[model samples]
Target: MSSRLYILLLVLLIATGGCRRGTDAPGIPEYDFMPLEAGRYRIYDVQETQYARNTLPLQHSYRLKETVGPAYTDVSGHRAYRLLRYRQTSNSLSWQPDSIWSVRLVNNEVIRTENGRDFVSLLYPVSNGLRWNGNRYNLWQSEEYEARNVGQPFSVSGKEFGETVTVIASNDSTLIGQTKRVDIYAHQIGMIYKERTYLQFCTDTPACLGKNQIEYGIRQIYRIQTYGKE
Candidate 1:
């Protein structure tokens, strides 16, 4: 080919590359729900409430800070990431050592092991209505977990995120009572919010079915207050 033609082809290639970098291009990478890396941490404000039949409800609020530490091998011989958790009660002014948790990515799912219980936190290729057994290895029997509102925008603590995912876990039947747990995660970030509601009632008692009857329940909520990396 002539030198002029070669120069023309080079210019066209550069133009194509520039176009791919534009905002309208589809070359951008997707967000990972669990971006486990050392030196990253997130802080959250936690609120816990407990309700029982014929008793006053009790509530407590606090702050929880979690930091990702070095990687280590778990009991199952899988590579896992270590998380150091710090807690600050309402009466305390400083954070203190809380507990240690382990997280691992296995079979395209993000699993977190806390207090000797394994929970499938997030599933790969997350999309709306995606469902799985988040508590398959837990003490809970026959719980169903689902993903919703994937890739949606969300805001927390005055910070905006381009994408977010919500995971819900509950039983299939509510004949006796209902127990639901929800976790919301922001893209590129970890959990931004979490809620759990558990209610139990006497099924065979007529007094328990009364409209004014008291039910035993507990609700806990966690919200992100601030997050950063070390």
Candidate 2:
């Protein structure tokens, strides 16, 4: 086991799947899908629906901004980026800090941490219809994510992207409730659109017999508004 041999093997690992980043090349494989750089930011329009039993559903709209602050080595010795999230409700309202999250690339997969929960966002060689467990790294129930509509053109907020990929995180529905989570990413841009729903409906009664009547739940959508480097 010589130093030269070890170094060679390490280089091969990196070239294969160690990290999605190398020397900032024009086309850096998966980097286009999950870009990780400092000072880059994106603004999104958010819509949420809340429901409660015996009450009308409440609709809320707001704006969210996510900025990549800086890169630092994490406990696992991998380079990670600090993600800062801001929220605003109205044009007159100033952006306020909402939360702090982190994103890192391990091997060939992208991991994003939110609220102390790790979720695998994407993997290398992103082929259409590829599936993987997004919660494999965390101590949670196994949740599968499938990549669809790869290398397709999409439009959002009057912006047209030549290439995009959609990840179906969850899709389940029953007579009583439904839970669906989806995210769309554009080439050179990050996540362009996101939608999630977790709703429970009425049951065992005439009014709630079909379970179509909502009892309580939450639905949310996020659409990209503006994005650029700072």
Candidate 3:
């Protein structure tokens, strides 16, 4: 490569390095705060949206509960059992949850459950009290990077209530770089609604160029009444 070309490439590489705070790519933005905090309230949205996945619309419903101890309702959404509890903690402006079964977070490093079982960890975001994990890793970054890396940039066309952002990252060979879009909901800022969809996507499949759109909606009825003496 020519000396001039090499210098230009080096510059590009340096700029693209993940070392630059939040410089993942040309469009990712780094966030400026710790994501997890304590004393935060979160409203779980169950099933409030819909879309066609593989050309067929899917109708799925599930229930979840936040127990106070090492127990939770069973899969039937009717039976209760002794499983584990989740403890929420935080510092200046972030909330971290400690589960009763396995997994914990200390000094930024995440530790899995002591038992030899597969379990997911939960941590709250700095923007009040939103819970997320590695599966939703982009939540740790700014809106720009979060939208770019994990999902897609929030566009006006995708806006809804209070800037709803949806992202899907799949490794299926038949759908590489398939399709990603971010729905922005900036209107319903304070009023937490009953139903909302977090993610939606449609990608091509096989040589037939068949398209599929899958979406996960939360039709939940929860409240987020703030607590503590402010």
Candidate 4:
């Protein structure tokens, strides 16, 4: 072979090798905040506090267990996973059926539907400061949800998680203050903690006959006690 032809072939080989390396490079790290598989379940200790208009705050504690059921197609033709929720009061030994929740991953986004309302739980390429409308399809209220403290260490219920993502959902404005809902998800596991607090009290001095005049509100807290997959 001619010297120029040999040099040309060598150049082509180098270019091809570079292209191959570029194609074989490692992809973006997968954030397993929500691993959807059958038989995966998580148990949580839940505390619910209710604040009525003219009544004192009442608190109730319970145990909540959620399990992933079989996969199925929904009415909208999307492949979805069923979640069975069970709850047990403090004095109850047997768990009672609370409700059934459904979720699906579409276009790399986790979508959950409850009570005919669709919510975008998590988005792809999960990173800090990621924001989305969690209640976009809901008619009652539009909530702005943001991902904060992504891939951060978190501890709850005597367990330490290497990486956790916290999503905060809040309404624009309310009668009293901002209504916020927070969810914390651990890597390789699902949600480990959740909190929702909303309180509206009568601020007007004349309308407020007493100092404890809460119109309506509720506070809920859930902490993961244990989780496993099968």
What is the Cα-based lDDT of residue 83 in candidate 2?
Answer: 96
lDDT of 4 at 216: 76
lDDT of 3 by residue, 1-230 (tens): 99999999999898777477464453311331112222222222233234444444454433222232232343435322232333233223332343443333343322233243322222222232233333433324322212222122333223333333322222122222232222221211212222233343334445433332343222233332221211
Per-residue lDDT over 4-30 for candidate 4, one digit per residue giving the tens place of the 0 to 100 score: 999999999999999999899854238
Comparison by lDDT, 1 against 4, better one: 4
Worst lDDT run of 10 residues, candidate 1, spans 23-32
Full ranking by lDDT: 2, 4, 1, 3
lDDT accuracy of residue 81 in candidate 2: 95
Q: Of 1 and 2, which scores higher on lDDT?
A: 2
Per-prediction count of colliding residue pairs? Answer: 0, 0, 29, 0
Deviating ranges (above 4 Å) for candidate 1: 1-29, 138-142, 171-175, 202-205, 210-213
Candidate achieving the largest TM-score:
2
TM-score of 3: 0.27
Q: Report the C-alpha lDDT of model 1 over 14-64, residue by residue, as the tens digit.
A: 999898778576421365877888888998988888878768988898999
Q: How high a TM-score does candidate 1 get?
A: 0.78
- Which residue pairs overlap in candidate 4's backbone? none
Candidate 3, overall lDDT?
Answer: 0.31
